[model samples]
Target: MEHDGQLELYTAVADQLKEAHARVRASQVPEGVRMALTRKLLVITAAAKHDLADAARRLESFMKDLDEGRIPEEDH
Candidate 1:
């Protein structure tokens, strides 16, 4: 995808996740249970963000290689 499209998709993903997290936070639950659940959710979100960062790094490297003529561009 083009840069603008990728950015739009990334923004959408972030917004959706934020909205979902807010909804979950607003739901009523026992304090202990809610704390445990929120902790797990935090771990999951952190892992996802880490993976996204790694993917972004790989994409950046790929784009740099292509731009520097170190990799061949496909005839798409």
Candidate 2:
């Protein structure tokens, strides 16, 4: 039962990650911003391997920022 719940959460997060990638790709942001966002997604993806719940929270915050037009500055 607990395992099944975890599996469902994993599946949902995976699907959300796919949609987030697509949204990033289709966004009209500058290249640098896009790259930064991609890096963030990559980190979230890696985190999911070790901590699904944490990764899901991170991904949710990321998506919320994106939806709210709160993009981070590009790294130097």
Candidate 3:
């Protein structure tokens, strides 16, 4: 349900997409708006995943640097 301390945004968005797709498939009339919205949602989720990956890499690098005493502490 949560990741990276406490975050379920990505998971919730994915779950919402699945539910929306089911509705769109069952509707007889053209749900152009729904389809478009779903597409946007897909793009956003994909972007989020990509961004998260980048963040993880940065976090790992930061942690490693800190462990090696190479990371400079913020000026207080």
Candidate 4:
């Protein structure tokens, strides 16, 4: 059913979010950069409440950036 599919998607996103958090924490980036990344993740978490699919897409893009070494510069 559609409900079941949504539940699965939610579960998968939740798991991915956890892994993403761990990755950010384990990353060697500077503290400011890590904090910014954390803020982005938090925004994605909040967005999931209203638009889960969009949140998942955002999270995926975020993870891809991390994996590809595309870290943002730390703000002064």
The lDDT leader among the candidates is 2
**In model 1, what are the clashing residue pairs, if there are any?**
none
Write model 3 residue lDDT over 1-76, tens digit each, in one string.
3464335544544565565456545545335644654454455456656775443444444335434644332322
The lDDT for every candidate, in the order shown, is 0.52, 0.97, 0.48, 0.94
lDDT of 1: 0.52
Tens digits of lDDT, candidate 1, 1-76: 5878767756754664565456447745455644654554465456556675544444444335434544332222
Sequence-dependent TM-score of model 1: 0.47
RMSD of each: 17.3, 0.8, 18.1, 0.6
Q: TM-score for every candidate vs. truth? A: 0.47, 0.96, 0.37, 0.96
Q: Which stretches of candidate 4 lie over 4 Å from their true place?
A: none
Candidate 2 per-residue lDDT over residues 3-60, each given as its tens digit: 9999999999999999999999999988999999999999999999999999999999
**Tens-digit lDDT string for candidate 4 (1-76):** 9999999999989999999999999999889999999999999999999999999999999999999999888856
Q: For candidate 4, which ten residues in a row score worst on lDDT? A: 67-76
Q: How many pairs collide in each candidate, listed in order?
A: 0, 0, 0, 0
